[model samples]
Target: MATSSSRIGARLLFGIVLLFPLTYANDNAQFPYALTFGSSTLTASWFTKSEGIKAIQFPVDSKYRAYFEDALASFGKRIMRRGEWHVMAGDELVPAPPDTHNEDTAVSLFRDAAQQVSRNLSATLGFEPTYAALTLSSVFNQSSTKAATDAIFPNGMGFIHSIKSLNKVAPAACVAHRLDLCGNLGRTPAECADKDSISNLILVLEYEKEYLYVDLVFVYSEYRTFPSVGHEMLREFGEANREKLLKSMSTYDYNRKLHQTLNAFIESLVERQLIVRVDIRAIVVAGGASATAIAQLRKLAHNAVGNGVVKVVDEIDPGLATAHGAAANNGENDEEIERAAEDENIDDDPQSGDPKETCNNDAIEYIFDEQQPQTFDGDKMKEMYYDKDAWVSGFNSLMMECTKLYIFADKYSIPQLRDDITSALVGHSHGWGWWPDPDIDIIELVYNNLPSSSGLIRLLVLFTAYSWSSSPNVIAWKDRFRGFHPEYLLDVLFAQAQLLENEIHGEGGIPYDGMLNSCVVHEHLELGEEECRERLAKHSYIFASLLSACQAANA
Candidate 1:
């Protein structure tokens, strides 16, 4: 009876299972084959398997999948074609080629010139131009000797062209001292090499496209030579006369000691103009030796160039020997820098062009108040080389010098010197007003050529912004704007926006005043309130419009 009952129950269960068949269901099965979602729809295959595999495996639902795929393909095609809906169409816009200056070539030529100068020093005793190509390239990009802008180009631009020497010989005083020790003792300049005389090489570089020569004198501080003319003068005038004699002796020795060297160098430009015609600028003296020597050399250089024309430069260099090595291997302070300050022009020289024009003391009346500590202390000429305000008055005249110094700093890895120069440039611009008609070409050249990491780029941009803001007239403004590199100009525009944004958002900020008054802009538009407002409005629109135009043009 139990077996029969079990069979009957099994049969009833089978019947019930057959009537209501159980099936397994996946959650993804209910997901639409293609569900619309904005422009792009999600499909089961898109979320699950790739479209290619889904197409092959699931051919039955091809209609819905095809609809979704066709829509996606059309959308992609529309995006690639030219249309108002797309941000951009077709391929990316090509960028314009960068306008790279011939700086690499210029740097190469300059380095070669320095090497030639170094090599020729041993063989020649004159003002020899070692590199013929040194002066081949025009310093000014557009101007020449006849061009009006030619006068604006700074000399040298940091190139060593001509080399002149203050001959190698024993001092007359040294010879005299030797004679006193042993009678009838005489040493010729050749025999007494490096004995009593130190043959200092004065490199004549191009300063403001003009040659800058250092008129130096070598003095003997030892025992006196027997009754020399310089000594006789010294006896008559005391200390002042003594300086005059030393100055006189320097010129005499230059001609006497380096006669052979000078003769050899006379074949080129050195002969025609520098030596024969004497058509030159002021001679300079580098300070750093004994105070007496500096005073004597300064007087001598002044006398040689004439009192009004001569100038003194600080001992900014760390000896030519270190520079020489630096030129070869781009290395750093193999040695410490020795400071030598160049004081102001000597006052009350009887031989001066204008005796009344002399300053009683040698103190440099620093152009800007920033250079207050530059007072001359007795005989010591201790003007700081890195003083920002020191260059305020002669900003334009000193640009080339600063450039050379920067390059020198770069070659020798002198970060402090470079930083100092950067500070000086900043002070110079601020002192003279933000946009005081700077030489944009030179600044551009420097900006383009300097190392990318240099701080000079920022300074250049700041000045350029000032120039742009303060453009006096339409033509001037257009020229200045067009001068910058497109990328750099964009950067400046962005920077200006940020500055305005900061000022507008900061404490005591001007509500809705996005444009702050730049020194250049304020000075240029010195007008009534209404006129200034109108002018500023126009400038803002024009400048904003120009940025887009520049981008398009560059593209």
Candidate 2:
């Protein structure tokens, strides 16, 4: 077997070899290009370390435009242009012609358009780009279009991934350095001055043949827009009236969509427990339509976000921002590859067990031996609770696992483990909501395994009371109450009475708020609040204090 020192030397040499080519290419003659595939137009921007940035727009062909429209209209179902055909006599099926339209035709069209644009760009610049990053219009940046996009763009070139890395680029020089032009009012500088203190909304409004594609992204400190926040939306206007009534109709449609989009984005953030409304501090507009609708967009944004600074990124052509961002993201990809290579060199010991399996085995051994466990991985438990597929497939099994762990912890006087299990159970319920019949099984398990004085028993009683009281089928719950343990039924009756009293006094309704509070569920008899907080920080558990005994044993 190789010694540890030899492994280290090998890793260093491997890392050097892996990164040398990329470093030399970046230094010498690397050309990175970004292609933003909009609904009506394709914008391509190329960046050179020496010559700077250049962008051009390509007209989309009518057939591809119709395909995009039809794809969106049918909610991403493949639009068949040619009916199915079968060979009547041949032993083997005949291959379809290249031009034949099928599920993959749309992806091919995208690739062909990109190739044509690349040729034109090469002609304009007198050299071909070495790398390309691709982004789709807001309308196509969705789960529905994921398959088509995956086929066209590589793993890391998706709009979300590119924009996420682009946020790391210095915001002040992001546009100015590439285009060799600064913002007119110095607004970009002022907004980017202390990026950590404020959240920025990057809004791109691109005009397509029949619709305006609006894409919104939030960036602040380490926070970003959630993947499911409906980042992209479309506003339709008649294409036939392009010249006569386009401006007026476009303004009205954009204004309405902007309002709706902002509301929905903000509401989603709040609902996901991500951020508050007041956190949004700036709106940065980019895209082809931005210049024309600057005044209206500014007004709408300020009104919606409450004193948020609105700035137009006009230093570079607004439509080129996505392309430029993509080009900037090339460096990030290089770093990711380097890190991945370095990771492969370490952790090569064949004797080491998987961390997750080790953790589980250690816990089981400790429980049986009546000895303190070496560590409690709260993150693993949290993962188990949040896994939607596992919840759907076997929720009762999951709950029973936690219940059994909690019962064992309580019996062995492992307060920290018991508290962690309680927090996990409560968080699971809060995340997925209550399941009626399975929850009853959980109650029986708890009652049979633990005493009435247990905090978990109390929490279940409150949850049961709240659920049954608010449910339309209270009568069914009442009938089911007969089957529950007498102590559990009594505690639930008291909790129901308390809920009624609170409603009567106009002070109740959300028992979960109290149940979710860390202090209410966690035991603090042995550890003080400050010590508990430190333990929690150490273990990274969101809702429970970490086990001091476990930490001591590990140390």
Q: After superposition, how far is residue 417 of candidate 2 from its true place, in Å?
A: 28
Model 1 spans > 4 angstroms off: 1-394, 430-435, 467-475, 507-555
After superposition, candidate 2 runs with Cα above 4 Å error: 1-31, 75-101, 122-128, 141-209, 213-216, 220-234, 237-275, 308-314, 331-555
Residue range 296-352, candidate 1, lDDT tens digits: 444444344332422333222211111111111110110010111124333433222
lDDT (10s digit) by residue, model 2, range 5-105: 10021211111112223343443234455566766667665444453544456767887788767645643232221122223234554433333345466
- Cα lDDT listed for each candidate: 0.29, 0.47
lDDT of 1 at 368: 23
RMSD of each: 37.4, 19.3
Estimate TM-scores for all models: 0.25, 0.41
lDDT of 2: 0.47
Which candidate number would show the highest TM-score if scored against the true structure?
2
Please state the error at residue 466 of candidate 1 in Å: 3.9
| Root-mean-square deviation of candidate 1 | 37.4
